[model samples]
Target: MTTPAVDADSQLLIHRCVDCRRWIHPETERCPECAGELKAEPVSGDATVFTFTVNHHAFHPAVPVPYVIAIVELAEQPDLRLVSNIVGCAPEEVTIGMPVRVLMEQRGDTLVPVFARA
Candidate 1:
């Protein structure tokens, strides 16, 4: 639905400062680096698992136990990272600094970004 994600549905939706070209995770009116205008942009789905936590406690019936919640650093920038889920594998298989690829899954009406082993 989101146009291949544009690159085979592997693109991650984010915002970038038009002036400084700095990627912003939470879009704002002005860029933090240069006060430039922010615009919605798509980035390469390439990323790495910066950190993760496996939840064994079930807080919701819809979500299964032992799911991986991770902070994934985007390949576009050194400090660029976002919170996402690791899928297509067991939670024990995920590790810090592990290479991952983004996938936009249909969650309700939104195509939420999730990561998988690359």
Candidate 2:
């Protein structure tokens, strides 16, 4: 099957089961809850920092040190979260419950969704 196209202006898309009304992450063809067909749906792109860690050591030469890697919970639903890097601010300034908005960045041919302080 062909992969779904993601637009640069679009927020992250999740799969929603029409029958069960359940949201699925990582984009799947079938709903895990009820064997139903799934559809791609756009999210609000608003989130809160659930937890984070500051990486002080540069893992790669191209990447700078003192960056933040965080798990942010979507405002739409509980447990609907994504692992992304927090940008537009200092790593030490990041905190739990901090409000954030999605910012798409082009990495090669893919558009990755990162978060920035709102």
Candidate 3:
């Protein structure tokens, strides 16, 4: 299948090592060993729910309670994961190792990547 296009302004979901050309994430100043400049760029934003937890209490009244939060592993870099909220499904429906994809969340002008079941 063809991959979707991404714009330049998006944060690098993972770090691509300048030396070894390997991908890493959560933003370090540079490659852990190489010390090369780290550049944040667009990623396909596809991932899988490696693991998750469900919360039944409301932290914010405006926000809904009984939500499932998870650490999703990006498809391109298995080790590159991000904490995201699982939506479009009930909290109890979440499961380990479930397939998910990216959904852009608007915060001011920024579009943060969130995940939902595929």
lDDT of each: 0.83, 0.82, 0.72
- Model 3 accuracy (lDDT, Cα): 0.72
For candidate 3, write residues 10-114 as lDDT tens digits. Answer: 443555776766565666668886777765456777788888998888988877888887888887865877787898898888888889988866756766666
Q: Mark the regions of model 3 whose C-alpha exceeds 4 Å error after superposition.
A: 1-12
lDDT of 2: 0.82
Q: Which candidate leads the pack in lDDT?
A: 1
Candidate 1 per-residue lDDT, tens place, 1-118, comes to 1222323454666788999899987566799899999877888889999999998999989888889999889999988888888999999889999999987788676677898999
TM-score of each: 0.89, 0.84, 0.80
TM-score of 1: 0.89
Q: lDDT ranking from best to worst?
A: 1, 2, 3
Which segments of model 1 are wrong by more than 4 Å? 1-10
TM match of model 3 to true structure = 0.80
- Give the clashing pairs for model 1: 3-6, 4-9
- Candidate closest to the true structure, highest TM-score: 1
Per-candidate total of colliding backbone pairs: 2, 0, 2
